[model samples]
Target: MRFQLGWSLVWATLILAGCASSRPAATTSGRSAVDYNSYNEDLSSTRPVYNAPLTNVTPVTRSAAPSATAPAPTATRKNEIRKPNPPIEALHVNRELDLILDTIAIKNRTVRYAPGFRIQVYVGNQRQDADAVKLLIYQNFPELSPYLSYNQPTYRLKVGDFMRRIDAERYYASIRRLISSAQLQADKVDIRRSLLIK
Candidate 1:
């Protein structure tokens, strides 16, 4: 019974110590007890006061009257053109960007092919039939230029280089009226030729 009582007291003391604040005990002089507000005031008073450093520059004392030798300040008119402080040539940067732009411009000037739509007017083994359809396309729509390709037994007759399906469809609708077998086929088209027709 004595051993159990001693262990219980030790556990209670350990719990009380753990629950106590970690702050140093406040010094009290000529006072019975310190209030919470007064303890906070005392802590604030112990802190160092903050003071910002001043600039070391001295003030320039200019005379009220202008000197006779000093040049008069010139004011620009509203319409007058002023020379740039730093010229436009100085602002140029990114040498790699210039090279990339030059390469793009060169590529643009040359013929470039893109995946686009075309109207297929005829596909047959006979060359004469393809020629007849090509003539008929020219007679009906003078703006469209037909392309005739022959591969062994098959000959494909396609017309108009279109970048969009909608653009091809517009001509397809008109061509289908004349040729019942006309279709919109996806093909690699010349960007320059398509843009010219557009």
Candidate 2:
């Protein structure tokens, strides 16, 4: 074991010495291996020298000044007149179009209702009861304009034109204090009136 250890140390020392000797020795000039001075010398040799004579240059001649009696040049413009565009005939709409427009106008004038939900604040056969409920809603919650509409034997006082049941449900929760029996019902809702209420 002692013999083997001594042989290993000798092998390691030999390997290290071989590696050190294989590398190139550094120069004493203290310059890098790139030799920047050679590159600078090459650049100086290729550079152009500017010691040529100015024999090719021509002398500039000055012109005489214009006399005060001579008139200055004036720019003249050609006369150009643009012609007017020809008149086009007015559009002739069909009578059927007027009928269609009249129909649309009549539809706009008529109460256009959408399939929506409303909170029924009161539903009774008595007109006075419906009016009272309407007045109660108007006085207490003016923002929610209660609509009073009669259908045959009964008059319903519905509050708010909710496009969705969720909206009616929300409004019902708020007005539940005033009208505990208020319930969401599908009704013909006026979109314009609903927007105005908001």
Candidate 3:
């Protein structure tokens, strides 16, 4: 596949070069050698690896940073929006919490490296409908691999394979800060590797 992709790229480059304008305009008609530089067969001329050759480009201005003369705009702390404090007795050290911890233990799983790790960072049972979710992923994360898990009672959708729990947790925290209800779930929910197409 990698070999085929490279071959395709080479052919594409050659084909594009062959089709470019090569007829030189008469110098007497206000044309010069400078204008034919693009038509020149000199492959020694530098071309960019990723973007188009020199074309109309506008200079980008980096906006000025706020000066010390003005007070910096304050941002609200994430995780500060507390749910109505659950009853103090309800906060007692509980077995379900311990069980939740046990389920996420990386050392306990028989992970198949062929399919990759069993651990995942994000999990949630969300209320957003399929259309809304499709919109969210399209608008916010157009690159994500999307799949729907429709079992008898629930339909779960997931995105991204995060290996380490810490990385996943950090991502989860950042995501939650931006969108409320992005919650963690017990690790018993299965994870599958994505097979992305070129």
Candidate 4:
């Protein structure tokens, strides 16, 4: 009975210690308690009130320190707003550079075909297999133009007239999901078709 009473006393002491807070009470020292009702009055008294008219106030102009040779710049009035000069319309070009650019553009325009990339979806002897793959690509990606051509015994199925290999790789990745045989190949791409497809 004595042992049980001692354990109960220890538990009671632990419970009391856990429940009791050690933090000190909040103190205001000498200042009075903050009154929320006089917020506007307190704010007004603390803020510096400006009596000057804002419309007449000119912005202080910052400039480089004046040299003896350079004349002092005239003071700008608040009302006298300076409009920015119109943007330069005419572009000055170097005659030699302009000629070379024009030549390159003309040459590119005249070229109907260029060595580029095409995503070959399938290449086999069976025409039906090629047609099936083409149909699959068409259904999944309507934007991609699939072409199936028979060359002698073998049939070829190619998709997308991509000028760059990077572009061809992008389409190949998506097509690979549907057709395992999809491959990126180098071919003469019609510039018009490539541009239109993109």
Candidate 5:
């Protein structure tokens, strides 16, 4: 009886002591249950969509592009022609160019500024015959200007202010052809304007 009483008292004391010192046990019914199955499966990220507000702008109502027809462009200045202008006569250069000008004027009929030569017509024939020859020469070529001289024993006929011996030789050949036996002598005589004119 004594042992049974001791064991009962010890059990009663343990029960009271646990009740006094510990918190109450929680209930599982009211709260949501955590899904343990989600821990194993793949789930996409959950982001918010379409947050931008309406812009409040007016819609543009464009009419047909300024009717397909327009007038041609006109030149502003009065002198300018509507169509392309004709090409100018010549293009003008900006600067003036210097040119050579002959300053000295020739005034007299037969004057010699420079010393030169003349050609003489040779005649060993009589004065009358030489005059006949001269007449024939003067008639044929009026361009040839001649001067006459007589030393009594000889009748000398001369023509031209020939600048070169070759010119005299040329004239001599022509004269010899006409006069049959005419000769040529190259001499340094004065150049005159009468030869140029005739």
Candidate 6:
């Protein structure tokens, strides 16, 4: 009975000591609690309010100290306007290249039209319907010149002269809003007319 009693007392003492050590210590300062509260209130009053307008805030200016390695700023020229260099009067060109370029230019002028791709806007038996679609395209998209042609029973309305299928497809996408039936097709595209339009 004595041994059990002694063990219980020792356990109780140890638990009490641990709880007392864990608790924060209160230190007595020279200033009273009332003085500390008044100091905090003064600080809060003096501090600037966050709701002030952004325009009222002054921007911080930075001063750049020049270093020994830094290059000095060049003085601005009195005449700000720049004059272009004189154009060269004479250009040296190989005789063979000049002849080839001249031949190509001559060939281009002679060839009025060539086999390429064109966007067919509409194809129907009624000529009036074809004319209506052509007029609509011209009114909205003046860049793409619509052409109407009669082939026996049907009247076809074609727009844009594209040398490549990719170019024709791009044009077809734009005109598809006006005429849903428009599609890219291989036809004799007017080379000279297309160049002039571009």
Runs in model 2 lying further than 4 Å from the true structure? 1-111
Clashes of 3: 0
**Candidate 5 residue lDDT tens string, 49-123:** 655432332333334653457433334345432433323432232121111112123334244544444445555
- Measured against the true structure, the TM-scores of the candidates, in listed sequence, are 0.53, 0.41, 0.29, 0.47, 0.37, 0.48
1-198 per-residue lDDT for model 4 (tens digits): 999999999999999999986755446685445556777544776789866433433354455676698555444454443323323342334566788899999988999989998888888999788878888888987777777788898899888888988888888888888788778989888888888865
Candidates arranged by TM-score, highest first: 1, 6, 4, 2, 5, 3
lDDT of 6 at 38: 52
Q: What TM-score does candidate 3 get on C-alpha atoms?
A: 0.29
Worst 10 residues of 1 by lDDT: 52-61
Q: What digit string (tens of lDDT, one per residue) describes model 1 on residues 5-62?
A: 9999999999999999786565666543546665533478679997643233233334
Residue range with the least summed lDDT across 10 consecutive positions in model 2: 74-83
Off by over 4 Å in 3: 1-128, 186-198
RMSD of candidate 4 to the true fold?
Answer: 14.7
By lDDT, who's the top model here?
1
Native-to-model Cα distance after best TM-score fit, residue 79 in candidate 5, in Å:
40
Off by over 4 Å in 6: 1-93, 196-198
Better of 2 and 5 by TM-score: 2
**Which whole-number lDDT from 0 to 100 does residue 63 have in model 6?**
35
lDDT of each: 0.79, 0.72, 0.50, 0.76, 0.58, 0.72
Which scores higher on lDDT, 1 or 6?
1
Candidate 4 local distance difference test against the native: 0.76
